[model samples]
Target chain A: MRVEVRLFGGLEKFVKDVRFGEGFPVDLPEGGRVAELLDRLGIPPSQVFSVLINGRHASLADVLREGDRVALFPPLGGG
Target chain B: MGKIVRVDMTARKVTVEEVPEKYRLLGGRALTSQVVHDEVPPTCHPLGPHNKLVIAPGLLSGTPAPSSGRLSVGGKSPLTGGIKEANAGGISSQKLANLGIRAVVVEGRPQDGGWYLLRLSPEGAELLPADDLAGKGTYEVTKICRERFGDKVGVITIGPAGEMMLSAAGVTNNDPEGNSSRYAGRGGLGAVMGSKRLKAIVVDSPSLFNAPLKEPERFKAAAKRFADILHQHPVTGQGLPAYGTNVLMNIINEAGTLPTRNFRFGRFDKAAEVSGEKLAEVAVARGGLATHACHPGCVMRCSNVYPLPDGRVCAPIEYETAWAFGPNLEIGDLDVIGELNYLCNDLGLDTIETGVTLGVLMEAGVIPFGDGEAAIRLLKEVYQGTPMGRIVGSGAAAAGRIFGVTRVPVVKGQGLPAYDPRACKGNGVTYATSPMGADHTAGYAVTANILKVGGYVDPLKPEGQVELSRNLQIATAFIDSTGLCLFVAFAVLDNPEGLPTILEMINAQYGTSLTVEDAMEMGKRVLKAEREFNLWAGFTRADDRLPEFFTYEPLPPHNTVFDVPGEELDRVFDF
Candidate 1:
């Protein structure tokens, strides 16, 4: 299965050559969770604060489907 | 002791009076709101002689408190027809505090229709004829004032939009860099200032952090501790300083609550194109600052200096302003957002209100969606005082009425800001109940709903929203009074010692033994006074509601409607 991943708020620093909001396809086993994706990106789970899957809040254990849009962020806040 | 300067515009007289016993403990919004409530008649016309414009600094504004340079401008709102207190970040608050000035109250209309400028210095206060500065943009006015007075003087001014008494016109002051972009921009306070024939206020003070403190050593210790608390926070110390407030664009977009196309949708596909990361890239390439402070002593430095392609500079494109002009109008370009932001800063209009008004105009087919050029041309019409421009300056609610647009996103009479209420229900409760009318800062539930700052409240659900908004609104009211930047809440909410440290600083400065409960009580008092003023001004429980469209229209991504009960909204102020 393939999932689309994007990083934001300097979380892009964790992944070389990937800019903010730029999506890249990642190959993972069927029913891969967010924790596995973080490990695949070489980003520690502690570094990423919030995770969104298909625009909904997801946890580390949430299963990812093929063609899912996943966005990872460092703790960021403004109004 | 501090003094209050009263400028009687009708008589063209300026008088300085000692701060009253009742108002000695109050500053910023607390002082301004109290002055407005005590002096201005509730039933009077907002733009008439009966309304008074009160400008005040926070309690710790002139102290060494970090990010404590907020200014509060209060008046009966021409836009909302209710009590309004609009806050801004600029050097004037600290200057005013250093000059021993508590509040500057502009009262009565000018019978002769002549323009004037109020000059405040350590020497005295005086009102000078400002006919030469009349009809100029805020940027030009600030520049001219800086040149005439020393460059360090803080000039707070309005533009032709205010001269025309447009409801969206906002009062603006300059940052330390002489960029007149910091605004008390909401509820049409500038129109109230304009009606008084006051074009600008030039504050000249030699000191910044020399406000008399009762216990200088204790205040210094508390201030140091507060700064460390801010530095230890990830959001304040790291993310904000790196990309500025515009950093929230991507996170909000990802959360599926970024109000797009004038709240017709939940998210904009091109959000990242105009986001903080992109802004930082473009600004640095153009020799502009990616991170700057709105005022001195601000450790967060969440402001940016964005240089446009036209060689003009918009000091900081804040998150709400960017969200307003970018996703709300369906314009994906940063330069366009920068241009609109610059125009608003120059013309003395609230960017949020102007963007939301332009969105309503687009909805009315006056301009097409995503047409940046047309939006620019229409916005420029305000300088010429065109009929269409007047409609634009009249704010979102008036524009909606003029064009018969039923889907206007407004609560009370003010336009809704960046977040879609349906998706961010806690903020929705805030928008519905805040006396200031659709002001997000009144109760920023986004901390909990989206950012997980204080704690997590389900953004998509209505549960635990009212309590979140209520507590935040109370805390925010108190923070606004302190004249500290509301951004401090990012750290203060997370840190256990935040509130206590703030109270200690206040106690050290004022010699008051206030507890945490007393701070909470102050917040409630401010809100109660504002609510009572609104009630006397004819606002009922029905006025505290999101528009009908929010209730019926289901936003995308989550397919959620604003489900917070109306009765619950009324309960927001039950304390």
Candidate 2:
């Protein structure tokens, strides 16, 4: 199955499909968890700062359904 | 009479001008902003002689007001090329006010290559050649300047980074203990000071110079009430004084707003290792102070002096610093965080900017995440003037350029502090829309009660957050103009009558009848002025955005992307 993935801040360089695209629009294994998706995307679990699935909170272990959206964010410090 | 001190480097002359009639009503950030806007040409090169560096004490400085010791430094920013003000706690603001010096303007550059240190006192001002102070870090400069001037003097010194002129170099001010650590750290104002060939600014004013209260009894009574309110509040009076703002590390992490490992999640498994409570425990064991004040004449003492194992002191590891260097980099050790704080301070670099930039560098594979030692090693390179160091100190955006990473997290060229937008969308809006170039303190109106504005909306709720951010930003501008430390907002927010009391005190002091609405108007006016300056300085709406990463990537725990639509965001400054 396919699930859309989005990356923010410093992580967007690796997305080859678009120079600046929202939602990575990639193929993901059916019922993949965040951990599996991260491994597939070559993003070390440690490098990813925050994650959101369709505007809500999700754990790394949560299974992603087909057509579900995932977003990746960098750490925040605007002080 | 409050006087404006002017130091012209080219002539090596110092002059004192009486506070101009037009600026008498302004203080702190308001004063600095007005002075810069009135005097400095909008298109002047920030590092050129055309730019002027203005430092002013808030209206309440030296007035025994609660948390009113903020000193605002403003100039054309080398980082963003916009109007910039960086305020911080230190002895300088109060000393300047006590000396009846409303503001100090450093103008022009010296024709000679020699640097100078400008010293001020009740008697007069002096310009001393500081050739020996060149290339010296802030710590040595502070200690050496203090020894030459006397222990009683308050000092402001720049570090090696300022000399090299990394755009984020901050002006280091001595705390009560004379550590050259407390800083007016933002927007590369220090670079401007450095460009003026000023290595240090030493102030040693007698108490005879203190500003006289127009209504002494009213001032005393209002001050008493203000102190009483702060003493009665928990977050400011107790929690902050006891645990310091670092306490927020745990709470924010719990709320899933703490930016961890470059904002990958709302939570960090090792958050306890670098929390305020944890730091408090460590400070107690190491004979370090956890709840010390950052400046003189402050009731809400929220700063600290963290001691490393070598008995060296690393001052006040603020929450944003901890999150930026600790959790965001995956380095949970307080010792490392404290050391980084010291490094940033002595190097005259902005800690939050450097830390966030380092996280971006780590994302670029130049340094591995959670490598505290490697980060430290890289920091040394940055301090020593390597191309890599220059890139890092120039800020995350510059670092992105050198490393070929386009996904830099910056607003108007200034790096964001340590609050993840995915976790706290309210703060995210603030990050996107603040006129001060991604600054958190730009909208620190935690006191919804005093604003007489909207009631409490859960920080997590998206509705009304834009308005909340806007109101808070305006209110913050007003408070900053008062030249008071913003930590007072936490205390004032808890007390239903706290903000009114502040306005009352100002009203009583200024001999005017300014109401809360008028104050709000001033806040809006200041914001508008700053926005106009930024626009004139070439910042567009595209610059008024979060990194695209925030939109496409969802944060962990409370996984939320940047849901605030772009059109809605563009409507932020519509008023």
Candidate 3:
């Protein structure tokens, strides 16, 4: 399965050679969990506080499908 | 013990009174709202002699608590015509607290059409005629006050917009750098100050963090722990310091909730051009700072200094200002956004209100969208106090009414801020229900709905939105009363020991054993008092609603409308 993964806030530090908002294509086995993608990207599970799948909040345990727009963020907030 | 200074503008007399026992525990928004609810008649005109302006430092303002130097200015809003408590991060609050002043109440409008300046020192406070300083902008007023008094003296002043009694004018104060951009920039409190003929307030105190504490050692330990909590949290410690609040531009755009071009779109094609990352890159390249503190004793330091292309500087252009002038207007230039923000700071207008007004003007074909130079020309008219300027300065609701633009984003005559309610529905609940009139800070559900700070709530859903907004509003009311920056909540919400640590600091300072329950109760009390004041001012549940267009008009990208039921909004205060 192919998914687009983006990082925001300080989470960009985990993935080298990528701009802040640019999405990187990642390939995962069928019925892959969000945690597997984070593991593949070298992101510490504790570091990523927010995960959004297609603009909706998602958890690490959530199953990922092909063509999912997944975004991971460090523990971050502002207004 | 702190004293309350009462200035009778009509009588031209200043008197210091002992803090009444009943009011001794209150500070910040609690103190201001309590005074306004008790003293001012609900039906009185906001600009009339009957409305009193109450300024207060929070309970922990002059202490060693990190980021606790916020000042609250409260009155009946000339903009919203309801109880208002607008606050700012500046040096004045700490100085006022160091001088043992709990609050300053300005009562009775001046009969004579002359302006006065209030000077506060270790000796006492006095009123002096300031007619010479009447027509200046806030930047000049602050500069003059700093030069005439002392460089360290905190200057609180209004600009020509306030002098003209515009509905969107705000009360501004100087930061440590003498930038008069730290403002209680909501609710037209500056117009209320202008109505009293009070032009400027110079606060002179040798002490910075000198609010006396009952148990200094205990307070110190608690404050240290609290600071550590802020430092340890990634949001407060890393993200904010990296790019400041404007960091949200890209994420919000990615989430499809950025409210581009006055809520017509959910995303901007050129969002990255005005994003925080771009801002930091440009600012540092131009010999400016990407991170600075708004006030002393602030550990987060989520502020920036952006040097403009014209050899000018605008400090701390936050996310909302960037959005209001950038994506909301279809302008992709950061310099243009910085210029608009700088103009609002000098003219003493609320940037949110002014930007929304400009968006309405564009909607009505008064100006073209994405035309930065034309927008600049219109804002100059505001500083000049022209008829068109007055219409624009009156706020987005008024501009919409005058121009017959039905898509104006506002609640209770105050403009909606950066977030699009149709997409971020929890914030929509907050906008529809809060007494503060579409204020995002009143109940920032974005923490959960989008940022996933405390917990996650779906931004695109109506389920659990009322509950999310209600809890956040209660928590935010408490945080605002404590004189801490709202940004601290990002850490405190995520940390389990956060609330108790803050309570420990308060108890150590004031010698009171207040628990978390008591703090929550205080939050409820403040909201109930404000709601009661609005009710007395003839606001019904109908007033506690988003604009009708929000429900009917579906925003793009997500194709969502604000479907949170009005009954759910009413139930926000049921607790």
Candidate 4:
């Protein structure tokens, strides 16, 4: 049930001064879509370019589990 | 013609040499590697007096060529103990070229205890005592250098980290706005400069000298067509201009190869947090530069700026740094990452290496994973010379040792960039085989259909990865040596005539009729020469490998280890 939320790149402003997303490894309230987690992080769905959970691409409805390292990256534009 | 500027630190002497006869065929990486191999002793200690640091502009530098302002800094890497070349974009290359200087060589060691700056103008070269600028960060040094040398002179300087000779130290270069934001940020080249006891190098823009152009009309015609190809390409023109390389964050994550949590996973769970769309949106809202060029005349303009809280300027955070610092270590704060980007600029370090190493430390629980504040403190507030900061700054291999973590992914002494080889097989070949260590740019072959290689293939394909990596690496070497931007490869490869156009431009500039195939051959030779230097430096096949962890611990999502056969990976020289 626990999901530790981490954000990166240009997305840190949403979490106040917390540069690294450390909302604690905790249990999720229930099953929800990726959109719901975005809401939790104050991110709009429109702003999300890519979403993956535990090294796999995730849909909003991808179920969360305990101790999942939920990592997020800002949009990538690499040379 | 541009000449080589040589400075004898030991004797306080300076001289300029004409471009050598054999080197007439080379530029960029090719020129740098060839020069280093022939001039420097293979067994020379990278940090000792025998190791000379040479900075060379690409073949196309000093011309009105698109994305051709890149300069290569080459020497034996203090970190890798091999021939190393870290390239960057700034005003230095073109300015140096304009001044009729082909390359600048800093040799021997300075006996003077005080730090000094090298000033090169159309008049000549001189070493100035810069005791006042010692220990200053790059930004402050640039401001002072600009005031003293006038704003037109290009500058390359180090930060406090470089002064301390940290292994991660990067050489900072001034951006178009005169900020010391862009860097040749890899392989600890700054430490080489630091070893010479030099603080900075100031270049006065030269107005008169032009490298002889063989056939000006043909070059112009070809350049126009090449620029057109770039404009027409989707990835190069549209995606890059709109989102920059950060756009790959989402796409690569979608493919499950973003390399999160210190190589523990191939993808991040919350990738959307820093996806390019999100970055683009925030950049729009916060007055951040949406997309810009790192160098002038760069039509691709993949580089962009990220603003501070009040929309004030901060260094534009690149995707490699973002992924390494963002998801790999489990941190998702963009501003913190941006601040770290700025700090790395000031500290004169590579963001990707720093981030990757920090991820290793985080995995070891040196500090809690995803704690951006802790990461910040460890880098900026805490002395990097301290045990903890040194562990992080020494790069991933060293940090992995300190943390007792075995999942370190590095080749040679350099840390891998953001791509996860478990998912992207061709890039895996690149990571494994590149002479430049674990560098993504060594051979960045995206989907064949994506216009980079002028065809499309499934990203998951295992069939053509070897050839793909081989061809791409050859092409990249050619591009890098020409001092041309690699992003231009996207556009050139897409159109059938793109490569020819590039060749046409080069031949036209040099007044030679060298064919495109010959250029490709030059590319191969550059890699071979660099590899030969590495071999001479006492590296072996065992050094050309991913760590044991990548081979054993199957990464998540795909549950795939680096599946590239060791034999096939080793045969990357099969061209």
lDDT per residue for candidate 3 within B1-575, as digits (tens), equals 79999999999999999999988888899999999999999999999999999999998999999999999999999999999999899899999999999999999987889999999999899999999898898999998899899999999889888988899999999889999999899989989999999999999999989799999999999999999999999899988888899988977887889988888999898887898888988999999999999889999998899999998889979898999999999999999999999999999898998998999999999999999999999998987789998987889989999989899898998999989998898999998888989899999988888887888888898999999999988988888888899899999999999999999999999999999999999999999999999999999999999989889888888999999888888899998
Instruction: Please rank every candidate by lDDT, starting with the best.
Output: 1, 3, 2, 4
- Best candidate according to TM-score: 1
| Residue B276's lDDT in candidate 3 | 86
lDDT of 2 by residue, B206-325 (tens): 662246777777987888898998787655565567667776665466556778777777778787678776776788789998778877677767777789888989888888899889
Task: Write one digit per residue (lDDT tens) for candidate 4, span B10-30.
Answer: 887888888888887777788
RMSD of each: 1.0, 10.1, 1.7, 6.5
Q: Write the per-residue lDDT of candidate 1 for residues B1-575, one digit (tens) a residue.
A: 79999999999999999999999999999999999889999999999999999999999999999999999999999999999999999899999999999999999988887899999998899999999999999999999999999999999999999989999999999999999999999999999999999999999999999999999999999999999999999899887898988989998898889999889888898999999999999999999999999999999999999999978888999999999999999999999999999999999999999999999999999999999999999999999999998999999999999999998988889999999999999999999999999999999999998888898989999999999999999999999999999999999999999999999999999999999999999999999999999999999999999999998889998899999998888899989
Number of clashes recorded per candidate = 0, 37, 0, 44
Q: Cα lDDT for residue A43, model 2?
A: 74
Better model by lDDT: candidate 1 vs candidate 3: 1
Among incorrect, acceptable, medium and high, the docking class of model 4 is: incorrect
**Cα error of candidate 1 at position B184, Å:** 0.3
| Every candidate's TM-score, chain A alone | 0.96, 0.81, 0.95, 0.74
The DockQ for candidate 1, computed on C-alphas, is 0.78
lDDT of 4 at A1: 60
Q: Which regions in candidate 4 have their CA more than 4 angstroms from the true location?
A: A1-77, B206-212, B310-312, B381-384, B447-453, B456-461
Considering summed lDDT, which 10 consecutive residues are worst modelled in model 2 chain B?
A: B445-454
